[model samples]
Target: MITKEKILERVGGEEYLIRHLVPTFSSKVRKKNYKSIFSEKDDKPSMSIYKERGVWKFKSFNTGHQGDVFRMWADYYGLDCRTQFKELLELIDQEMCLGLNAERKSIVTPKSIFPNSPTVKDPAASFPSQTLRIEYMSDYESFISRLYLKYWLQYGIDQSVLEKFDVKQVSFLSYTANSGRCLSFKYFEKHQVVSAYHISGRVKVYIPEIAFSFSSDPYFKGQKKSFSYKNQNKDDVFGLVQLPEGNLDYILFTAGEKDCMSAYAHGFSNVISLQSEHQMPSEDLLRVLRSKTSVLLCCYDNDEAGKNASKKLRDSFGIVSVQLPEDVKDIAEYFQRYTPNDFQLLLGYGVQQVQSITVNPIDTHRVRRLSNTKRSKVKSYLSNKFNFRLNVVTQEREMSTKRNPGLWEKINVNELRDNLDRHGFECNLDLINCILKSFFVERFNPIEAYFLTFEGNEFDDGKDYIRRLAHYVHLKDPTPFNTRYWYIHLKKWMIRAIRTVFEPEGINKHALILCSPKENIGKSYFCEFLCPLSLIRYYNSNPVISNEKDAQKSLIRNFIINLDELHQLRSNAHVIKTWLSQRYVNIRLPYQEDEITASRIASFLGSTNDVEFLRSDLGHSRWISFEVESIEYIDDEAKYILEKSWEQAYHLYKLNPGSGELSKEELLELSQRSDQFTTKSTEAELMVQYLTPSTKELGEFMTATDILRYLQEIVGITIRLNTKLVGTSLREAGFDRVMHSDIKRYGYFVQKGLI
Candidate 1:
């Protein structure tokens, strides 16, 4: 039952077992005064048992041959320590079965290679008819030695020169194409050749489908370039990274495309997906990554062959494995939920200008009844309000590959539903559609219609995206329960603004919001509390809203900004706010003109840097940052206290639909208390207080940056202001003048670079 991997690790390999074990045991047993081991006519072992110590058994496919059933003939041929191994393989079926599972087949197999039992993920299939297992340990080498030495003496070793061979010979695999499913090998040492045919002795040979590593090195230094296929056909299939002299950086591999597909789907898109049936070596995959930016494998997942292929592929990218999620079953699914929109958020641009936008939240009666003149006005309003230029790019695509087979197969919705009910999860259809939709909705998440096909590798993203969704939901409601449990807790709170806009009631939108305490608390927690998608989408779309004003809306309609961890981000001495802010806002790669979106945005921040939000981008107005210092929450634990905290946003949204909720005093307090912007000295504070305009005007608000920088300019200077000046409604022609203490000293800080 030893696995192909474990077999190679022992007894040399499949090749060695074929050429040596059978013969080596024969010469020794016969010389020990044992009867001839085989019948002359059939050439199959015919040894008999004496019901004593060291026994031998012959199990082979030749006797009434059956599939994978290594036949057992000799039951208990007793010999002394002279014939231990032959007896051990006969008695070791229980242990071997631990590593691999074979039925009452012709051969005894170690149990590790097959299912621990006949049942798959289904438990009902586990029973005596389908072998069940309860233990898991494989001391392979020790077991090998114990079995071999038990029968080694009977093999008649030449003691003086046998010490090296005395150690259990590890198994090595060899490929043979001439015999279907048969294994064979001949040994030629530095001086002599040893062939075994009639010498197969009392033990029987159990052949397996051969496997090989593509290699051509003189000493098997790398993967071989040639392969053995059906019909004994020879093919040139593997190639290494060849230099000018034809030397390779490493060996290349030959494996089914399915293996490479799983690797790519799991995020290692750098391995070649070959058409060969022979397994690819781990080292070759590592080489492929070094040779290219991306690689993919596409293969069918019919059995263990597929699972093993992916395991080896992942192992090739060992460290990067940590970068992948544990639950993804295959590739297409991984990308399904992590569209490009989420990337920008991770790359540090989820702030004011990186937030999600709304374009005409609802279709109004006016919009529906507009005349041509009014239509022109409406288009103009859209251009000014949303900052988007509309256009359509369309072209009929010509097929470059074979025509899709499914195209010829007619289908209807009911048929699709039936097929999906049985096989859709395997293909990840719903999730793929979601990803496709997200892509079209955001420029940052441009969609690609792949040569769609159903394969196991398509669902890798399901596990990871689901986990993220669950985490978001958990933040809103810590209780571990079903979906309905969450809806109950959040329904009332979500109803305030987002409820009627998401489903039967309304449409829903995606938005990024940041929250923070005065300077050192709660932003990360706040991000968690937002319930990013799942929970928010559920209740908001129920039969909630009852208004004609809500009809003709976008697929998305309302959003909230949550930023409780802002304070925590500010206090970290080394790249603290930088890391957190990077994930929530900014354009990291100025070289590219495309907008950043979603999780991909998170990774683009690289390590750390300042993330500046452009006030010019239409993204600015969609988000609303809340200051923890400007507000307070009543502690509650219906599910989690954070849910109660997030409720404040709904209240604000109801009070003012999009951008007009927080009052003037709230904003002023937030600006003054923000740890990221304040000057430490009282003089600096006074300078900041002196020139500030006392009006709530939009144009004046836009200058807040220059005003803060000016304060940064006058930090050490003495200044005074008529603080009462704030009461006046300042004129719309907004302007500010910088105040200074000693004009001479002011330039000194600038000269010394302290300012």
Candidate 2:
């Protein structure tokens, strides 16, 4: 009672049998050249089935379809073909019987075993099925389709069997979003047609690629950056890219590599960021959108800074900033807060993808520091206090209380003058004027005049001023140059400038320091150290601080200058190189005032950016850019030999000094000789030796974070730390990369004396 349908279930169908069985098992065994399972060429399917007492079974396969030729191999091998067939069936069930492919034996109770039509006792179980489940070596649409078309008769859903696919049943799955592009499936229900999912109203996230290594550890933590820090493949992400030739489009930038990854999952193209090396200019983005005209939409942060940056980018890209309701911020929020219809209206169909910018302006500390209202107060306070006759100018542009444009020098000088005058003693205007007029060299201190004014008095005004200056210097703004040296120098210079206020050229000689309330909030370190250092120089009436030859002193100045710009910088290495290489680069000085006049003290000492530019210009002559950790607390008691510390430090700087602006080549040579001075481990030639990166310390300091914290401590930034959020503090301190390393190093140094 073997039936045709029953046979077909196992051997595919008539087509499969004719191509494999018929030729190998024709009427005559000798004529058909029949071979046994042991025969060299017995792999023909004609003899695939075992026959004993009208019973048949299958044999295990050799490589691919070996079991299909089980009988032939069995007969050739002269073994019990039935046993081989049974063994093959068992193996097949174990490997492929799971899912819908599990075999359904004949309820067909075969009625005959004739050649024309395989006999079966019954036909119900023999009838092919309408449903089927299949798995491929990989998820590939074409491969899935090919497997179905080629083997349809076996699954009972082939076109010849079922005739069509029930497409609605086709569903895809993946661990991540963008891993579905390679999936393809179709369904066929004997005489019925199936409809696919409707695309009219739904937003489908399209997966552009499927290439991810299955991770074993479910709780694995990812690297903080966009790229894999260790053992990462480029293919880890589904890169859905828009070609450059697409030309001109308004680009909306977002945040995080994952955000971009998710958008790519949706198949929307044109979004790009740090994922690729080629940075598309705003003009280029606009150019592509020219043909397919559409207003650009920025679904970035709803924060004030985010809005400003979005607007700024829109302007640069020649696009309009689509305003969202006050409550909604990003695309995800747009959906969560509104109905589907509203969301669709907001995000028009067929638009470009979203990408978040990484090297953005807001990330700079200076920008963040200046943006706060209370922080800006410092800029204003100092500005008006310096010069009551003029308004202050600050970089915190949103504040209305910022000083007016121009008159920075007059303002800063006036503030210091007013403070001194309040103490009941008049500023020594003439002596200061004389000192500045004759101060021609790169190095000199004018502070001796102040000390001289109070030389015989214990309640000395000069000492009090120096003390106040020191207190603020301890405030430690990250940019220590100004905090330690320049602030003090500027204060003294302003006092001198104001004393000669009636003299020619006295009105605009110094830069202004406009302070808004809380302006120096946590940024007091710079004012503390740099200002004091500057005082030690300017207050001395000694022509030395500027030209101090202490190898350590020069290095400290270079470090301070670098840290300031580094505050406003994203690429410290690149900026440092440019600075050391003597190339000019524009750095938008963080404005102290929101608005400014033509003649304002935008930067009293100098713009951090300008200072950065000069680092390279004077590399060899002024310094070699040696790396060092900023000192947390210099032993003031041990620091100076009162009579000779200045002279000793000065001598160190003059040792291998070059005159004027030293070239890169000269700097390299000097640094080489300095490091190789007979013994590098002992009695340092350069300060780097004495100031080690704690064998336990980071290469540049107590981890850049601790150094930044040290800087913040000295300068003061209003940062609140969780007792447990060590990582967060390190991140904010700017030593985000090796924060743990830094903290560990710091601890190690204290415990091991490695620094």
Candidate 3:
């Protein structure tokens, strides 16, 4: 059972044997020869190693003696290759720790073979512990023939990158729980393969003879692919050897060798990889790296294991952790799905400080209201009493906190002054401003620097928030008409509201409109409650839109801008629509000298006590209108719902921000369902008296002009027929738009009905 092939496979291939047999052999050297070990003393170094037919062979020109690795191994023991081949296999299996012996008898290695070998003390020690003895082959034919390069190519990794990282194609791999000739990737250190990372299942091998002679095609067979690591020498890091010397800005440590190479292929350098996410370099090695680089960033697989490992590295060594999207497993797969620029956008989110502190809000309130606090005590009071925490935390153009972990806005000096003044603490404006600047520069805890958004609550999962939102709609609009789409719109709006808090630039274009026939329906009160209590200061129920600039300022400053009395804005419909569509506002605050482009963070919520608040014209899709029977007072429930929902939304947004986006199809469906809320036009009602939608038995295809002319002449309608109104009326009267296929023109399918 212990054959030469099995021994060779266990010790890595022929290439591995040669590298290990001759310790002085350097694969990097070209046309270089080493002194022959077979001869007693050769005057000249005449033995050279070269590849022949996918195998590594050695030859000595001095004595005209040369053969494969087996011949060389036998010659080292002063035995003939042909006669002593069996003994050579046994010696290899024992010395290399192949564990191939069936009888469990320990055959001693020949003293002559390892006469000066360092591993002679331990006969089974051919490689360094925990490192791999990876086989290397220069035969591009085997690499191409096995079709192993395609796996890396699909992840945007080319042959050059694979070769750069010393990745080799393995046609045959034998390990525990796996033995096959399937195509796999072997990661080697110089000439010896240490680790194996399989990217795909078994690939069909291209048999040249079978294909060229037209005898048969490539064979298709499937095998259980595996990922494994083996060790031969101390060199474990994949890209560490290739790293440039000293003083780098940043170096990325990825989950695997492929992820490292993938980053390099995407135009990022100074990157290295671990054996796996779980394996980290020694403390000494990490310290040396820290001195050489400004920052060490680790981007591991998006799984729980990778996340935990990355966090450990961050906590232990101050290495920054870069988070990957939930869908991607690793950086290689990330590049496969997204562009390099998309990855660059995430780099800013990773450069965070190692430490973060949390301050108690109750203590902060107590500190702010202290009567004895003077200029000298400002720092101590803010730091100790107010419980202000600080850190250099950046998350996609905003500060991210550990407690509330999303984007947050930094509070300006004016806002801080206002807060202190309101809390009954009197301090000079200049001193207050100076202390704030110093605190900011010092990178104090997050709360002192940025405005606090809603923190995630463990008890709430957002289901109640969703339930309340659904119930809120049902209570406002008791009618069964379009209830399904209303709920759909409400869910989407809530998602967008959450998104706006995290991603300020993400505009929530649609506004929820609550209409009622009577004034006592509590529409405005519910709209006011839509904003969370924490953000109630930024909620304006009576937004003055008379001055357009003021309206823009309101949008820029507020979290929720309620456009109350929707009927009062009938003449301002075009302006309101324009405001709804805007993603940014170009305006200057009183504190700023020049106008600055600011993102629109405000979400609109409207209320009206008029039944026909909506106009006859189109462009009402942005107004999510509903007729309310009544909105009963549920103050406590509403506050709890708003607060908890925001927290839940924040959690969900962090997971996937793109989930808030509305597709074109979804918008169109919502738009169609919104038709019931639009006030009916007089012309539409008049046309409905005589016209009905097409029936198979009787109908006529007519253009808007033709329909208007018929209504004016045949029906003797004296009212001035507006062209656009006629088209709108036709659709309103259940006249379906149809194409006159023969004439190649669009017309309405209509039939004459009794008045």
Candidate 4:
């Protein structure tokens, strides 16, 4: 009898036992985490097992229970302690007995867990004696009957090829004195049969009714199935044993064993086949081919599934596809009709034809013309006329304006060369270089290309520009404000917008927040007018800006990040603040493995219908607010004014690019005036409604719990409120607190005052 320690040592370790047993216990397992959530229909193991220290441990998250590998096995089978131990011993003994071979002569531990271990001698002696049995025959008549030989000859395979591969007929179950015969193909590893496939000769009505059985079948006999006796190192590629042992010039890959045999009969001795079309060749087989062969040719059947598999193999290993004649379906069928010499000639002609047309000719002048036209248009539009840039940061966002194709069309050298060759033009490197130099401008600093031009008209003066823009803005939202207030802010915004295209330097960066409690107030339209619709990146709602990584991803390729109909931004207000203040940020693209430090070229602009959008800590300096009160539809007159205003602003911006800055006193005063438009939190508004300035003399004290109860019960507020949130809002609204002791608990004393 083997002790527990001896059993563990003989089977390598607990990890080996679990690895070999997991598939038998669970149907589905996640490769990344090795976690399996089993179904209740069968006795499945619902847990994740992993190696800890020197032992294997498992934990079931569903039940919050943990144990070792032995316990897991017992739990899975509902076995008692004595029976479980007996079964474990039998498993180890079976593995050691089957694994014993003449070459190694012992079962060595796996290299991953135990690197240094002295080999135990005579492992086969520890279990019941057994031997592998193979019934060899002398010739075809003695091996398979004449009927079997005829059946195989129908597929164009001769008896000599079958005898060379050692095919035989065997019987598994018998009903009469003479048992029914089935063809058996032994799968060999190191010249020893590890498994045998038994193909039945019984005919069926359906095309897929060819039944087969394996020596490794679990239900072959009424006995407990164990994986320990199975072949641990089976070859993925079938028919590998028949190939000659030397370097091969080429290897033909087929989809089935019969096809491989047919190819060999057709004088292609160096051929291998996958078990099925879906089963790709293993990496080890591919590596051998790469070392010994120069070319790999896939000869799959001429069906949709076969063609798809051929393409998959081609993509994986850069192998070439060998096309058969349209009349023939596969290698076996082709061999039946044509001679071996004829097929060889056909393959040679195909290879020569492919080599002759290796490089395609191109039209150099056409590519040069397309590149030049695109580049000239972009430069003239940005430098002279007003053209907008539209930056798409994510797929979920839909921009209101069309994307500018000219700005994004960059020239690729390799693509240009290929196009030239296809169009029959001789490729000239010097000519391509000249064209590229004319179109592409290199920037020394990241801030060189700061602004994208708005596609609009030119204006005469700043005053006329402001009036036309104000009329256009008024057409969208007719809420009238002080004339001077509207003029100064509108003028400042236009200057900033124009500068974004020209000289975007030496300015305090603040995100423009266009907010109002009402909807359809033309806030988004106003932003569109200030910058080109093409140059703006639009987000329908607030993005989850939880960390600097998220911020970098969102702001990498845009000039203006526009948020529309934003309702709330309480969670990541600080991250947004950092994004607004930094002139440079670290960016990492999805495809790139490393991060790149680049200048922050994009500005933030957000429109919201929520009155309580910002948290208390988001200071007013990083944001500029404008309230849109009412909206009106644009008529012909307003449209004309808008067009003329855009023309005026375009000319004004070109004449004087750097003109959008306010004095410190003016900025401070503007901030104070904008504060009136700031949104107040619900708690802050409640404090203002309930507390009076004269109530400070009353000097009332209340516990946080009592205050919470009053807010929830008396006020009938449905939202869950905690003391931390309440206190934060009250403090932002300018309320002072003092410590107070009650009979039951200590609380806070608050002097009521209007905020």
> Among these predicted structures, which one has the highest lDDT?
3
Give per-model CA RMSD: 29.8, 32.3, 24.0, 28.2
lDDT (C-alpha) at residue 24 in model 1: 38
Error of 4 at 339 (Å): 95
Error of 2 at 453 (Å): 43
lDDT per residue as tens, model 4, 1-755: 45667656645666556654453333234342334422232245456676678666877765554678776644443334354566545434544332222122233221111123222222222211112122322233522234345545756667667644434433221111001112222312111112122111110010111123322333222112222121112233555656675687677788766687778776878877754565566443665576667667778888876797777666555566787888989888888888889778766664554333322123245334644764344333332322222122231111111244344333455655565557555556555444333212221121222222233333345457466555444322344545455656556655554454333232336666677776676777666545543334432134446655666765544555666654456555666777765544434445332223334456667788865465456766666666656545656666556545545555655666544566697678766755565566665566567642223347566655665665565457666666776676556555555544336555445554443
What C-alpha root-mean-square deviation, in Å, does candidate 2 show against the real structure?
32.3
- Residue-wise C-alpha lDDT for candidate 3, range 105-189, written one tens digit per residue: 3444443533454322223322222111223344655423334455567677787776465455543332211011112333321
Per-residue CA lDDT of candidate 2, range 223-272, in tens?
11110001111111112123133343544444323233233323334443
Q: What is the lDDT of every predicted structure here? A: 0.27, 0.30, 0.60, 0.50
Best by TM-score: 3
Which 10 consecutive positions of candidate 4 have the poorest summed lDDT? Answer: 200-209
List where candidate 3 sits over 4 angstroms from the true fold.
Answer: 1-456, 459-463, 469-488, 504-506, 652-673, 692-706, 713-718, 731-755
lDDT (tens digit, per residue) of candidate 1 on 1-755: 43335443433333333222232344233332222222123454433322123333333322231111122212211212233433334323221222122222242222211122221111111111111111111233444233323222222322211221111122322322111112333211111111110000000112212113322213322211111111101111222211112232222232432233323333332334233432343322333344442222223233455455544444333211112233443232333445433422322231222123222323233334442343233333322322221010111111111233222221132443354446422323453232222211111110111101111123332233222222333222233443333232233233333322211112122123333223333434434334433233211221112321221111122233232222223332223222222211111122222111111111100101112221111122222322223212213332343433234333433444443223456445433323332223442344334553433332233233433445545653344322222111111113343233434221111111123
Given candidate 2, what's the lDDT at residue 640? 34
Q: How far off is residue 125 in model 2, in Å?
A: 70
**lDDT agreement of model 4 with the native:** 0.50
C-alpha lDDT of candidate 1 relative to the true structure:
0.27
Positional deviation of residue 581's Cα in model 1 after best superposition, in angstroms: 9.5
